[model samples]
Target: MSNFKRASLIFLLAFLALPLAGFGCKQGDLEALRQLKEPVVLQWWGVFDDTDSLKDIIASYRALHPNVAIEYRKLRFEEYEQALLKGWAEGKGPDILFIHNTWVGAYEPRLTPLPPALTLPQLIDPQKGVEKSAAEFRETRTLTAQDIKNNFVPPVRDDVVRNNAVYGLPLSVDTVVLFYNRQLLDQAKLTSPPATWSEVKDAVKALTIQNTDGALLQSGINLGGSANNNRAPDLLSLLMLQTGTTMVNPEGRATFNERLSLDGQAFSPGADALRFYTDFARPTKEVYTWNADLPEAQELFAAGRLGLFLGYAYQLPYLRAQGPKVDIGVAPVPHLNTDATDAGRKQVNFANYWIAAVAKQAENPAVAWDFVLFATRPEQATAYLDRVKRPPALRSLIPRYQNDPDLAPFTAQLFTAQTWYRGKQPAGMDAAFRAMIDAAVDGTRTPEDAVGFGAEQVNQTL
Candidate 1:
């Protein structure tokens, strides 16, 4: 063969050999090997005691981005604040962290401000099912703002924005509900749950049972451990809000100390709300109940001893599992008579949100943001709600689940639900409120005194 012909044959053979070599190669093997050479490591600190579901989510993310490795550290809710603060001060904090919605005000300075480039009209449009008010407030034009907004519910969107900037995205939304024992109601000859606080008081009076020996057989409602538990500050806060009392000033300062005026009369409504809660446990009223050492509050409700409970929507699954025969029904928490907005509507449920944020000191903020954006996408959020059995945050998800009989009340409350921040000192303020409630319930101080003192304590922190 001529030299040119020989060269052409060689070229053809080389091309054929290339295809043959590729035929034996695994799909994406080359790309996968290349990705393995330079993996990005992300440290994620999460305040989720329930890790199984979070692990599954992380695994899913990893499957999508094999080149990125996520290291997750779970922290208890009570200890997370201190732990995260310490980690941040030491510059050893995770690349991503979970923050409670109310905590954004406290942690905003410590977090990185999302770039303006990410806050574009397309990404920040409220019409896209994000809270228009919040988007306008947060100016959320950052890299994945649209994706994050779309993933979250309107309330979550509202919670993450502060001073016209978006600080984080919510992973979950929680609200309080009245979990009542049908057996207890039926035994008491009650046909329905209390529709108002006065009815709640009367029901509690009827529900209380004492043994012949005078030892308590069953208590009506357990507000908290000795009425001092800080688990439900928002419950009291809601009462204060519904009564037209602002819990905090615009600058995030505690305002519960202010003597609220109504109809030309000065009153401490916060104190009244607190007193009403504590008085239930007063022995004279025969409403005083709850033992910290015995069956937990939930257990009491499940066992048919407790008639009612103030718990979150997330508690439904556990309640159903633990109290299979207890026949339970959920309603919004009962409101004061003066709370027209809440009273005219279903019960008023307090809103709580769990948020996802990128640490200020993250080594790879962009990558961490990408993960946040992906996890908070509307579709992903809906999937998460399904997997976790928690309520969805996005407005669009409401229609999808509106027909759900179990979820209708909760979905309706999300629209007018409220939250409060006790300035930047959440822990201290929470403790003070708990102490105030405890004092009032134990008769050490009246509700008026307790609220005044508690407000002072909270204000001092501001």
Candidate 2:
């Protein structure tokens, strides 16, 4: 029999015991059968990080269920998805898997909903001086859609929930923040980083220096140009969100180009946001500093010549290692304004992280989900966060890590962090964003037309 058939039969027989035990059969008989049940081992595939990072957490799960073992394998990012799809097609996929938040829509068909709850046989007493037998215990526990919304950051709900079903859980979440050079700010006589786009414009003017040939000697910020710019799509998306541009509409169509009227004022937020972003690369604009000829943003930031670069927590260690002499500091991404009078203005950030999911091909879906829930629990999640050093996804743990030096900025923005569904072709959607920027910069299309064209292209992917 296939693994699925065998697993189905096993679960069916286990349920059959429930009715028998309910009909006056001795409970000890069921307990004995549970104790004699064969052990279950699960294969887990991951990306970006190694297995050693999770070895200790896996060991902790094994302590509770001595019969369960988890084998973890980390794959290269360039090859992960293709390998996973091929493996699943051959019926040899891992039991538990890690997938990108943006890829959830594409993988929904191959994923299994988390079991509501599960019962397991465990040892309760230990100090009896004699060996004690384990007993079957009922665990009436499940994470509901509401529980997910209440327990995690806001974007998590939109990313993991589908058709009112909880599909996955995230251990950590990352948000883009302003990575600035402390020394550069001091040189410009600025006491602190800019908190608004206008202030950033003024600061860039004061900080950007020019050479005799009109070439940039030191740039104020990294923005515009998609090929060499690091995370250009994320930065542009952040601006669109801050300007209240709904990238995707209720019908799953890309409608970011739609114009709006506010109090008799008409404007296209997406177009305005695109103009605000591309102006930095325009020589005619006051905020002009960077251009297509500049080095990569990350490299420029590490070289201590760039004033600001937008990045996530995952790059902290790398930035520090790459530039030991550079004095760097992190701050929340700038907002339009911090004034309370304009309460309609919302503060939004970009969210990027992986989620833990149960594969449909798993022979032991219930057991795999049990381990997932355990790993995300407060006690266990702390270990994973400490090792990974990413922002905590759980709401309760946010306060504890809010003061962390590397995590503070990201945690501060967790409540406001948001993401958009990029359809099944997320890469293509990102490419469309780049193409839109290119069209605007080349003057081939106005900002309004550029955004409309981009949305139309993305709609095709949807």
Candidate 3:
């Protein structure tokens, strides 16, 4: 059986045991489920999560809409895109899908916008042994664009709404955070993780240990290189954003590589960020620590040899499992400007998460969307988050995690998080970034030239 085909019976039973009172058992729920006679099945395709994470929500939703049956399938990330594309091309695909926030533009044409309201039959549940009744229907209001802004954080509204149409909804939002080894920090006599990039530079100088032939005996942090570092693109992109680089202009062209006006002077914020990122790989730089010769960053950190590593909430599981004895400490990613007193000061972070969207090919788009709406409610969403130990996407749930040590760091950064438009070709844009970083690190091109070339390449995709 394929990875998507296999479902663990144990996981299903555990979730089935969870109480559905708060999730769905409202006063009129039984009447609706019993009266409906339509038999509808919604196929939900996801990449990261399995049925275990959603089984309870599915059960709860069924309790309210007995006519609707949900079948969830989880595919390997590598195979997910091809499968979705192939299915759509064949005129068959899942009614519901999980897409990355960046994929919204590229995949917009293939999605159906959430409807203003869903009109359903009063007696549609085939299990209730009743036929569809004529002229008796009920209307359900779906979320409006304004409701999205009022509910989720700022970035959620920015990503899901385009052309005044809401295309997707997210169960949770995740941000990049700094992951470090606590034992290494204690040995260095540093009391806490670095709060500012300036502190990061100082800590790197102190933690890095070099051998006689200038080989790295122990590395300080993971920065300044690509290809080997899986998250190098995100790191570089976040740095450019923090430096006030406008990644894409109002005309929707790739301008990160070009110079922009800053305080009545022409400056290249993207090039500056590139130079700063590649410096750590240069042997002559005072803050040198990382190099292309080093192993993959997370691996080094997992083995407890690297002092600091930049990562996301999803990467925590592997780190903990691999380095069971490693004391892992997470902190908010460092900021460019440390002045909290400045009224104009703003802290920027990067966003990377998935959004639930309805495919244009869905046979029952309205019913499919209604399930999506019910599953994202606070009560249902909180259960999923609590089970998975992840952060929240809704503003109302932020305070619930304020005192949580593991999730607080990520939750604190969601409000000001930002994501840039990747035009209609996010993959092409991503490739350009990797090539630019490589050219600068390998000395094949100056930071300015590399960024300019990258912008030119990205423009072709736009």
- lDDT by residue for model 3 (1-462), tens: 665445666667668866564345443544454436558888899999889998889999888766789999999988999999998889768999999998899999999998888876554444444434322358988888899999998888889998888999999989999999999888888888888888889989888989999998778889888877898888899989888888888888988987877679987989999998888888889989988778899888998888999988888888999999899999999887675111137788888889999999999898888888888899999988887777899999999986798889899889888898887888898898989988998899999999999999988887
lDDT of 2 by residue, 318-417 (tens): 8888988899999988888854111156677889999999999999887889889988998888998999888999999999899999899999989989
Q: Which stretches of candidate 3 lie over 4 Å from their true place?
A: 1-35, 122-135, 261-265, 340-344
Model 2 clash tally? 0
Query: Which ranges in model 2 have alpha carbons more than 4 Å from their true place?
Result: 1-37, 119-132, 137-139, 340-343
Record all residue pairs in model 3 with backbone atoms less than 3 Å apart, i.e. clashing.
36-124, 36-125, 37-123, 37-124, 37-125, 37-126, 38-124, 38-125
TM-score of every candidate relative to the true structure: 0.79, 0.89, 0.87
Question: What is the per-residue lDDT of model 1 for residues 94-132, given as tens digits with 9 covering 90 to 100?
Answer: 888888787787788788755555321121332343222
Predicted structure 2, TM vs. truth: 0.89
lDDT scores of the candidates, listed in order: 0.69, 0.86, 0.86
Each candidate's number of clashing pairs is: 11, 0, 8
Q: In model 2, what lDDT does residue 226 have? A: 81
